[model samples]
Target: MMVLDGEELDQLYVDPSWQSRGIGNRLVDLAKTQSPTGLALWTFQVNAPAQRFYERHGFVAVEHTDGSRNEEREPDIRYEWRRGPVRP
Candidate 1:
């Protein structure tokens, strides 16, 4: 998934059988590289696993919507990650 000007993450998915195998983390790393300043993504609130995975990767919950705007009408949360200062 690619977003210009660090706007958002369009999509990131791993096959269910490939989950828990670090693929998602690698993809997240790639996204960070692609958007060096930051990246944001929306995920369904019911997806607890996705939330945990994003949190573990340094993403913080920034906002939430109550199923009003989306076509699916499912509550969702927005998470963001900003590049931090480099350490020696």
Candidate 2:
């Protein structure tokens, strides 16, 4: 079991070969069942595919922040799914 949050998700990685094979969707579904407040994650502004995947899973952009890591500033988007019932 993992506790998902903005910072945590920003560091998450999915294998390239397995990127769009519904692995992420299934992982998020598992997370939702274990999470008391549903699933949440963050993706970089340039990561359109991940953003779309999250949106398909009912996550919506809830916030944006300066993703400054090691003194480097980058745009990051935060998404959350707090109210939707997970799809079958």
Candidate 3:
């Protein structure tokens, strides 16, 4: 995970073999402690499971990219989480 300017969550990834084991949750929890006001991250559009995970953690989809701005040239989605009541 990469937190930029002590705010944005720039990157987050866990190996497939290490997923479903709570590491991500722990990391996010730590991130919250570091930046409780909010956090943001970008994930590939193809990663549906990641989207679900972030949503479960109170993050909401906020924006999308069309593969034109990343090194991997893949479409992506940006998610954000705020320190307050959850959104439905």
- Tens-place lDDT per residue, model 3, 25-85, is 9888888889989998889999999899999998999999998999999999989888997
Q: What TM-score, computed on C-alpha atoms, does each candidate reach? A: 0.89, 0.70, 0.84
lDDT of 1: 0.86
Error of 1 at 49 (Å): 0.1
lDDT digits (tens) for residues 1-88 of candidate 2: 2345532443445678877676777677666666646556767888898788789888889988878752446788889778556489
Model 3: residue 72 alpha-carbon error in angstroms: 1.2
Off by over 4 Å in 1: 1-6
**Can you tell me which runs of candidate 3 are displaced by over 4 Å?**
1-5, 85-88
Report the candidate with higher lDDT, 1 versus 2.
Answer: 1
Q: What is the lDDT of residue 46 in candidate 2?
A: 82
Angstrom error at residue 59, model 3:
0.5
Cα lDDT, all candidates = 0.86, 0.70, 0.86
| Location of the lowest summed lDDT over 10 successive residues in candidate 3 | 1-10
> Where is model 2 more than 4 Å wrong at Cα?
1-11, 69-72, 84-88
Which window of 10 residues has the lowest lDDT sum in candidate 2?
Answer: 1-10
